[model samples]
Target: MTNQTSEQFWEERYRNMTGQPSGRPTGKLVEFAEALPPGRALELGCSRGDDAIWLASRGWQVVGVDISATALAVAAERAKAAGVSERVRWEGHDLAQSFPEGMFELVTALYFQSPIAFPRAEVLRRAAEAVAPGGVFLLVEHSTAAPWSFKSRTPFSTVEETLASLQLDESWEPILVGAPKREARGPQGQTAEVLDNVIVLRKRPA
Candidate 1:
């Protein structure tokens, strides 16, 4: 198995990547954000920048971070083509070593998992702290493996389980938390039912 934690592994993956967009930003991001006013936003593991670009289009100044330089390059180009380059920035980062600077009105980690072990809980703790006063941190993750997935990751934690582990302070309010079923196409266009664990939290203003 490839060591996903190493930059070289991701660099190679992105370098070999050849595909259309990673599909449009999920309805989840648009639905949760459309109601809220836009401001600075941060997206972790922002692979091909779909969600980040969508947020930029919605008038947020977005900073997207990924470990692969190739991925960041692609994201930058995508933002440019969308005519939202001025509203978004892409950074190459290994989350365990460092993260982008500055607090944000919204911080998100969508499907942020890896085959290689990672300090996901600690990273999310920092993600919570990165939210500015009155800001929101939205987490969306797969609750199970894809029907055809070959990667052997353990079943993902439920929304309730992840929240319980976060151990957030009283300053945070849970806006929404649940695992919902959705229909989706696999890489080969086969149909599958997938469960998504979604959690949205808002930080109380100081």
Candidate 2:
């Protein structure tokens, strides 16, 4: 899909959301980042901002980026409710066209997927570049389709493939690389074990 089409699609999706999210950060995000020292963070496809809020609550200044303005608004409100509004900033971007400025000590993109045609690989590469030296870039992606997902038949790239696509040099060190299985709950309360491709890379100090 074109960039305009993708924006409209995400906008409509978030606009129809019935209520706020569960106010829970993705389990993988908390698992990997909970022990890290707080610093600047950038969360791509922040959805309703649970991850960003979690980071901000831990004293990390956060910038949450998403394509849907409605989603950003909802996330901003959520940050306010969590008393971390001052620590979080929200920006709307069609990442195909532009990205948030500056670098981050912790950059995360969890399940950054879309059914529409998007340059996901390119965007992810840019995300890596935005990671400051000695900082971490954590990526988690669906390795298998969820039962309730509209893109059930869509094939996902493996962790190795994704890392290769980034084309990082020796300045990047692989901290974690594997497909991990996690128990997941579907939209209708159905439960299943799902596979996720995870890669955590730390940029070597300059």
Candidate 3:
């Protein structure tokens, strides 16, 4: 599907949903952020802007980009509620088409899923290109197609496979890449174990 179509799909989903889809930063993102230097940050697929708001609250200038305008609105409200509205810039963007310009101190792609019809390689390449020198790129994605309510059937690649497919630049260093089990609330309000593959890469100085 084209980026425009993808954007519309997400917009409709958020518009119809009862409440905010996501409310907090993913665990992996929280850990990654704690280790990075605070500066300009960009969050791709920001959903309702939990991570972006969290980053902004920590004094990092943040730009939260999502395909859904409704989602961005909720994110903006969240920032206001959190008392950091001025620190965040919310924008509607389709990652498949183009990425925001500028070098970022940190870039986060957390649990951003796409249908089988979408092109994953191009998305990953664009994400890699958006990272600035001495910046960090953190990716946290579902590692398995477990029978969860929010699960996607699109076959997920391992961190190793993704990095190998991308042929990352020599200046980019892989800090951590592996599958980790996490506990999350299931559809029925029960606890379930989910596997997530995390990829933390840092760009070397120019």
Candidate 4:
């Protein structure tokens, strides 16, 4: 895929899909959210709203964002179907160009894979800035250089390498940063080992 395609590429991916992809919230996100103070939450790259809708069901006001309008439309439909439409807001946004402005008590980006040509550091920095004080910023990204994703040409950066590139302030404390192996069901209905890098950062009160 060309670097210029960006969001349009993702939009096409969703447009062709028959329905939302089936997957539960990443383990890292569930763990972090369980320990976090509940309030307004933002979900970046929320594909079909599973995680965002789950959070809303737990009483947190949620905003789910994605680069694809098709995906957002599906997510909105899912929210309405689940009877949590009032609790979640779905927006179409391109993170590579700009991040939405607003302080949130918790912000999460799960499985946000970047293209090799894009500057991942810049995107991560912008994500960090979006967190409100005393808030938590969680990132769960695929760490495995799986053969399946290789064909797509999406760049997968290791957790350590991405963290090192960030110029985070001293107030930002690291809660967890490492690659964890988890059991996941593959496309063919077989269980497989999945490696994911998780980072949880808490912004200290200024």
In candidate 1, what are the lDDT values of residues 143-169, reduced to their tens digit?
A: 877778657466678788899878899
How close is each model in CA RMSD to the real structure?
A: 1.4, 1.7, 2.4, 2.0
Q: Write the per-residue lDDT of candidate 4 for residues 1-206, one digit (tens) a residue.
A: 66556676787777887744674666677777976657999888899888998888788889898888988888898889888899998877777786776889998888876553555568878888889988998988887755444343654678888788778879899988889997766556667687888888899987
* Model 3, residue 106: C-alpha shift (Å): 0.4
* Model 4 TM-score (2 dp): 0.90
Query: Compared with the true structure, what per-residue lDDT tens digits does model 3 show for residues 106-174?
Result: 988887776525676677778888888989988888877556554454667887887786678688998
Stretches of candidate 2 off by over 4 Å are 1-4, 152-154
lDDT-wise, the better of 1 and 2 is: 2
lDDT of each: 0.88, 0.91, 0.80, 0.80
Give, for candidate 3, the lowest lDDT window spanning 10 residues: 145-154
lDDT of 1: 0.88
In the range 36-107, model 2's lDDT, one tens digit per residue, is 899999999999998999999999999999999999999999899899999999999989889999999999
- The deviation in Å at residue 5 for candidate 3 is 3.0
- Model 1, runs deviating above 4 Å: 2-4
| Structural similarity to truth (TM-score) of each candidate | 0.94, 0.96, 0.90, 0.90
What is the TM-score of candidate 2?
A: 0.96
Clash tally for model 3? 0
Clashes of each: 0, 0, 0, 0
Model 4 misplacement above 4 A? 150-155
